[model samples]
Target: MPTQHKNIVLLIADDLGKYMGSYGCPSISTPNLDRLADSGTRFDMAFASTASCSGSRSTIYTGLHTHENGQYGLNWARSHFQTFQYVDSAPKLFNQAGYRSGIIGKVHVGTEEVYCWQVREESGTRDVAWVADRCEAFFQQATVDDKPFFLTVGYIDPHRDISTRGGFGNQERQYGTRVPLLDVKPEDVEIPRWLTDLPETRQELVEYYKAINRTDTGVGLVYEALERQGLLDSTLVMFTSDNGPPFVNSKTTLYDAGIHLPLIVRQPGAKAGIVNPNMISFVDILPTLLDWASIPLDARSSDKDSRLPTSPPRQGRSFLPILQRTDLLPESDWQHHVFGSHTFHEMQNYWPTRILRTRRYKYHRNVAWRLDFPFAGDLYASITFEGIRNVEPPVMMGQRKLKDYIFRPPEELYDLDADPDEVSNLAGEEACESLLLNCRERVTEWQKQTKDLWLYRDGQSVTMLGRYAKDGLQVPERLDFDVENPGTKGVEMTKHLGVDAYSAGIER
Candidate 1:
């Protein structure tokens, strides 16, 4: 590692929450991560743009909201899932800045864009042994070559299959782990009330803990590699997740459990023990890393190029100043609001949704079809079919049920201060007049500014007219549907959610 450029290593786990030993989750053995936390700042108020893998990762890479990045769905090939080649994705910028960049494990960035990188195929967040070895090898090579590397290592343990909940899928295999049984009973796990209380959910939480532990062990390998190469002090390490855990309303919703993620950044030669509570978005990552590495903004920089022509809004400010001095920027100075949306696993044809979050208030705009069409089928079984022959195709087909789950009318809202779970809808509450008004205004402004169909205020007319016209009745200048790739129909469905909502006059 060279002293001129700070080495960057980002470790991201799938579907992790603040349920780690470092964050005061007792019984979970996350020693390696705990050690990292003990030596760096653990952010308590960081958030992902969306809880789903693709949405969150896209937001992190583009330094833009999921809506802005055009990745509201699980798959790519739609206009919304378009890769941010011209934006502030860390890998793109880092590679252009003369740094060797690579990724290991699961990457939600679109397949089209990822072909340029050296990537590993294993997906999920769990105790995969091979991931650690590959990561260590990458670190060693980077060190040997004296390169300031931007390497992203993803872990898929503690996710689905190998779950503790009465075993993963139908195989019923209990996953072994080092974590102890805490006071956390299965009933104590806070999640959507719609899900049934079962042994599976309980064991699933334990499996998640085990997966976290394994991820930490992998982290330790990289840390040891850095130490062996005598580059510990020259590297800046970051640990976080794609989204919230994969239980209940956590992973796919706009509630705190879904979007609020953990972020820990350890810089070289800096204070060892510190905590910064500044509210930051995943989009701010690129600018922060670039600033840390002292990389100047050139023509290739998203910030630099966008300034020349029309500039869409960049939803987050750089964290560099806050990193230098925790008090330099107040939490409010960092953001007025955060936005999120989800259209993945579109049961009833890709449930489209948009959300807004302030410090204490949160609002959701559901632009999907009605929610009562049908409950999704048994797609959860795929987690257990791992390593089985002929399972891949069936698993993939079963996932389509996730896309068939019914959706409901185009609008919803919640005040997180009073309803952290976002269970109650305040969209029609007269008492919340002021909050609703402000939220609607903000969302409309953002939609118009971002050229989304969600700018429409009439939910009824748009839906009726869209249905009548047979070509989505789009709100003028709002989000429109465009199929960028022919094979992926899901992308088109997700992209049309906002347009349909706007056309339906769903806005408050």
Candidate 2:
């Protein structure tokens, strides 16, 4: 019934927030996820690089941010937001190492051959039992062949159904006895601080809770499958979500409600009941898995083409060393800050935002700040949003005004210790000038490293216009173009944040 082969199983949820009991949510108790946390380490400050579904998943697979990986939006036939053709993904690296790699749901990322998953049973089914059955068969096959496996089980629950404003895809189908649908009412839920506590929001939460339960059941079932195969100890399992819950202020935004996620790792023979407080990123997922699989970092890019040799390096290092620790990692041992990149959700949703989030502060640079923030198609159609907009003039989305949510400034800085909800803006304040500048420069350096096209100066992309400097062309050293005094000469150029070139980063 067992082989001691090292294996990896990544469990990804569709659109989930940190709503489990383990994360201190009082609304719904996620017993399965709580049990999972009890058996392993639950990271307190895990983050996704982007908030969009495909974009976030791309970051996890390729260990690069959305801007760096070329999946800056949803991957659809019409949207065409696929990963860059030359990028190396997790499955390819595992498959190349003679490991059987496969994904058993929601293959949303790209051209089929590029991900290179050996068995791709793509589906949108929310049936946890059926999904576990497929995983059980997959494990059985791997056990028979005595080959190590890299499996990704993507769950499609807890995400709002785009077909309607209030449906969570739980109305039409029966998920059987293994997955007991929670009988919830509008009155039974406590609304999140990120959403307005309206009747519409409460009504949607009833349906949302049922889907969350199904996701919890799926996690339990998948783990049970591993137990049945006696591969529990040999396998390293991970559970996380693509982004935050599907709400107006949560899903597609770079706010904490969006990118701040739940990441639990059950490494084999690791200490149980560990609470790891290191700031981890979704970009580190592939590297951690590769490390656990004993695959060298250089083993990737072996398939690099000479014609397309500009493969970006993985922006995250492996967190394998810190995954089993119960104590908080020191700043030197683990980074206390994480960066975020978001460009789009739908094709219409194209507001590019780069973010720098530390333990105390958050900085956001909205490149398309002039444009009114666009909403995702499903989010806009939601009954909760409908209720918010069809109300009084000063409608509130959650605790913040709807107008403030729609119209945003180019830069936003927040002291997270004072405002964890990120409602206050400090970028325009005189007292926060030094802090704002520090955060802005930090994000800018990251954008430069990721080669982000949205890192613009004087309203123009700096990298896109790099070749024009030899022609005596000098752009203004400002964020936006100056129409009043249009003089590029004698005005100092906005140089890098470093005192000199060749330095890694600017210090205070």
Candidate 3:
């Protein structure tokens, strides 16, 4: 039988940010990833919807935010937050299209029924070579059956090891007798702008780089496997990470370093070796895959009888059209803005943040501004944090003060064009008031659309209130109360349905 659709091989790296040779980081060695980027379209502005492990992966699988999907925190260590049973996942979608969907290594997303992979090989070791070997076997089997496979190879590389001993677990003998070709020296480590350059940081970075190099080698092996099985041209190969590195100011935070991922997609018959700068979210991944497989969007949802009323529909559109474009589109021609939400990383790290990022501005609405921000388990025990805490008089992490990082304002706005590092807060500035308000409104509208639970302030959920009947009055089309000052009037909506009326009167 002739192949009807292209196969999908998604290689996901754990805790890896955009710090590779293809992304213009010279110190790190990622030859396989660079080659893949050269043979595909490298997305410069791809971002994860959430920064935590299970939350980010859940977004990729279900095309819904953490708030809607219910995988709000880590999946292991007694923090077993599983996705809602009614939610449709990626493997289930691909399976419906008659493809054998399988996953190898690092299954953090959730329950067996929700993920439903046809072939599941969960690995605890961080050995990329071993993972590549297993993937090769899977590719060979798929070749035998002539099945269009949707294989997701999750590499546990580049993430911190099980201990605070600063090892990335790249031991060669643990996987096999194979030796790693790429090795990074401590002195050659290029420190990220958000991290302080110290001996411990450099040393740990070396291990991280080694793990990344191992992952790259694994990628090369998988590519070769596909080639050997005559599936290279018929495969849509995508390589990306779950979130940013395991470090302070990156992993669990909604900062650019945390959510900004490295995405390279080599579509079956599209133009290759192009750098696409379009802003895409992780939520778009499932839809894009469905589109590529010629599956209907409605195919992902549950049957009409079993659908949950509170479960919001998928909020992402496919970017497959952008991939087919021969000429580069302008920034305005693509998605102008992307939204992000992070409710928790670990069970205790409950700092719910919502962000709306445009080309020039970023607005972060911290829901729990009064509480001290908690840290992830790995980040708190990291050697980098040790170095930062050892300094006298308490030095700040990156450009943020210790207290400021813990106790943040309710809102934060940054001009990305002027302050790319997000060091300046323009939320309170008089000149940026209108822009801030507009961004805030956009975020609030998005929250309402997604039915976010964090849209509440001061023990009152404006979103929830807007949905119910009040004093026999029809529900307002929009909630116009100021988020910063809950009692103040911002924009008032009329009681008449379909009338876009606004009044400067406070109802409360």
Best-matching candidate per TM-score: 2
What RMSD does model 1 have? 9.6
TM-score of 3: 0.90
| TM-score of each model, paired residue for residue | 0.74, 0.96, 0.90
Instruction: Choose the strongest candidate by lDDT.
Output: 2
- Model 2 bad stretches (over 4 Å): 1-3, 496-508
lDDT by residue (1-508, candidate 2, tens digit) is 4557889999999888787889988778588899999999999999998888999999999998988778889997599999887788998889889899999978789867568899999998888889999999999999998999999998888888778889998976876889888988888887888898888888898899889988899999999999998999899999999999999999999999999999999998988999988889998999899999899865565677666545578989899988877676788778889999999889999999999999899999999899999999999999999888887778888778898999999999999899988999999899999999899889888877766777778888775665556565566667877789778878867653221211211111
Per-residue lDDT of 17-67 in model 1, one digit per residue for the tens? 776776766666677888898788887778887777777877776666655
Report, for every candidate in turn, its global Cα lDDT versus the true structure: 0.60, 0.86, 0.80
Model 3 deviation from native, Cα RMSD in Å: 4.9
For 43-119, candidate 3 gives per-residue lDDT tens digits of: 88888988998899999989899987889888887887889776788887788778988999989988888899999
Q: What is the lDDT of residue 392 in candidate 2?
A: 79
- For model 3, what is the error of residue 498's alpha carbon versus the real structure, in angstroms, after optimal superposition? 14
- Candidate 2: TM-score? 0.96
Candidate 1 has an lDDT of 0.60
lDDT of 2: 0.86
Tell me how many clashing residue pairs each candidate has.
37, 0, 0
Say which prediction, candidate 1 or candidate 3, comes out ahead on TM-score.
3
Instruction: Return whichever of 1 and 3 wins on lDDT.
Output: 3
Backbone clash total for model 3 is 0
